[model samples]
Target: MKRLCTATLLLTMLLSSGCENRPKQYERTQELFGTFVSARIFASDEKTAEAALDAAFRRAAELEQTFSPTIADSELNAVNAAAFSQETAVSEEFSELLGLSLRYSQLSGGAFDCSIGQLIDLWDIGTEQATIPTDEELHRTIHPAAHEVISLQDRSVRFTDERVRLHFGAIAKGYIADEMKEVLQAHGIESGTLSLGGNILTLGCKNEDEPWVIGITDPFAPQEITATLEVRDLSVVTSGRYERYFEENGVTYHHILDPWTGLPSDAGLASATIISQSSVQCDALSTAVFVLGAQEGLALIEGLDGAECVLITDDGTLLQSSGMDAYHVKQVEK
Candidate 1:
């Protein structure tokens, strides 16, 4: 439930060890999906690089129109507006993404839910008019029973309850990033980096031998890097309470809400970073782990194959998944 902001650009690229010659790199940044989207591609010529970047941006824009819940005419908005009224026919792409989101919701035991839009609108964390809703208001408005209401049939969806609403804020960027990578590859651009706010998807590598170095943001001080991860052809997504929050009466409220309580999660976690082959999986898992808390989050990651995560607690302790130690470089002490 991260707000579309400049949170992910904190990922600074580090110099690769023993890498003297770098490929011809072309990079560009644009505003999309309510935040900054940047792409770096290494190609044979400038024209080829620019064309690939253009294609990537175009793909991102298209997906934004399809997935953004805030956009009035978006496919997701259409589904929300039609809840309990009729079965809305969606595109194959939309259906697939929705299906994937539901799968994550099931896996996390509802810790991460796409249908928490009602709760999100109640809190309105990123808006200027955001406020803390009363417990009664939350209880009355919160609708996390999406599993009971939503029915997916091929490329169509129906909600049996009018209260059900869909929001892809948790997983859209990762899916778009993965799509952008595919667009880049189709244009003969093999090596590149797609930074969609907080989701980072590396395309191949900087060179044949050098793995891209990604700096993990310190949840307490996002401007500083608490650790670095060296990865290639993988997605590194970090979900943190510090990414979007508002302070009221000397108390802080973040964007990640617990679906069960319809309030900001008090899961004692500052951030959760997930690394996996699929950006969509990593993106959903990061939020899921953050909401699941440290112990349960660690267990979830351990049980999954090809997934690893580093969970930073509010008290500054770092909890790593069983497979995370191999990619964990240096952890900074507070």
Candidate 2:
């Protein structure tokens, strides 16, 4: 649960090596998804680029309202209020996204649950309220199993458990990135990069056929880069313990909470990076693999079709899926 992104412009974040040279780059950075969303559009002229950027970010803003679990008026918040009591009607888009989230929750054995709002709030990892609670406190908070509680039919959400609540912080950024990329493409913007916080989704390749290069953030050193990769029309997303954590009595408490234990995950992974055609998949699977730990996480990525990952283990070792070699050209920093 990476929390509290700085409300600032995208300042050449450590995630990507960045683009250079010509194609009429039109860049705009705005704060969204609790982090800065930077869009770099390469179009024919200023007007085309501006229109694409405006339309793309407008869609992003709409999604921010629709998907935010904490917002009072958000659709997800509405579902949380009404789904347990009634068959709450949701948009076709919301129904579809929730369906995908449920599938992922099953696949991860609940490691990447979206229905853990209570558990997350209990931990309160990024705020002053964050503390190591007693076993009694853990016992009291009930994180409903997503499989047992949630049901969807005909663009409506229905659920059985009162404990179940929606929290889309994990998937919304990537989902919005995937969407903004579509908006850009629909506007006939050929080459661009749309980054929603740490999730970097690229449009067509840079300068025609060249691949976009992205750097992996160093988990141990948040200010630095560990490695970089070449990719085309692909997204690079990382979920790491370093994103949010606090030290207490010589023990480090991070924000990546485990749904099973109602505490932070000690899953032997400092970070997990998923490289895929789909940004949202990268988003969900990155957190999933991190919470699953190094060995099991690597195995999970290897088994999945069209997905590859680079895992940073707790001991600071780098591991990768079988096909990661195709995109992994740079050795990680020691």
Candidate 3:
């Protein structure tokens, strides 16, 4: 399954015009590697904005082609295929992502593992043929390669078991988003926002005046926002069951499988949103907190510096981390 990509638009006026010039930069869905990408970015001017957006989208597609499991030639997929059998030297991007995944896995106590690739493929959460896999099959397929199989040696890599596969679905976009933010800043484009799917990163502000206002879409009602958070120079990433799923035999199964059970995490929470300075951490922690549940997730966020979380439960309970109440969350009656 995948997270939906949407951005809160900026509506600001050039003071002299006395009218709002809130034009969208580039908003469209295109097939990148094997999946569709909903991409958007905001910039001060149209030409440079479009150029930067094109560069970002191209880079992301390049990464996907290199890392996507659907591509046999992908370095990552090949690496996964050879796991436990041979050693593979990966590109800088793969190494960086793997390193980040390892760090987060340790920090989250294995709740966030990139090694859930086998289980993800077994469930096939995004496809039409999604079903509840047999326990025997799950047990056989669900292997936490993060802890056992995958090993990072300097800039090279090796797998202890061929059965272990790695997937970067959870964190790659955020990393890309962060990179694109840097690209935009380097291009001298200040006061803009870029959203690669749901991993959003903003730099400067809208027109150098207003802080970017990002809407936290309700997991239950994505068309409607649950709250609005004012931000600048930050990234917001969310993990939820609503973005992708399928129903079979009256049972609903979404992505976001737990590493421990190889099943969809039924952590009583419907959604978890994370805000941090690094888009990579924001994206990783969104999935981490989803698996950690509400209380423990809050504790984890509290322990981490410069991290904040908002957890919305299945029963309409809103649990905010210590600093998230400043978002002015407006509770709606059911």
By lDDT, the best candidate is 1
Candidate 1 clashes between residue pairs 3 or more apart in a chain or in different chains: none
Q: Compute each candidate's TM-score over C-alphas.
A: 0.91, 0.90, 0.87
lDDT sort, best first: 1, 2, 3
Angstrom error at residue 205, model 3: 1.4
> Cα RMSD to native, each candidate?
10.3, 10.4, 9.1
Show the lowest summed lDDT stretch of 10 residues, model 1: 6-15
Q: What are the per-residue Cα lDDT tens digits for candidate 3 across 102-159?
A: 8898889888988878788888888766778899988887665385667898677887
Off by over 4 Å in 2: 1-22, 332-334
Model 3 / residue 285 / CA error / Å: 0.6
Task: Return the lDDT, model 3, position 298.
Answer: 92
Which residue pairs in candidate 2 have backbone atoms (N, alpha carbon, C) closer than 3 angstroms, thus clashing? Answer: none
In candidate 3, what residue range of length 10 has the lowest lDDT sum? 1-10
lDDT of 2 by residue, 166-224 (tens): 88778878788888999999999878888787789988899899989898998989889
Q: Among these predicted structures, which one has the highest TM-score?
A: 1
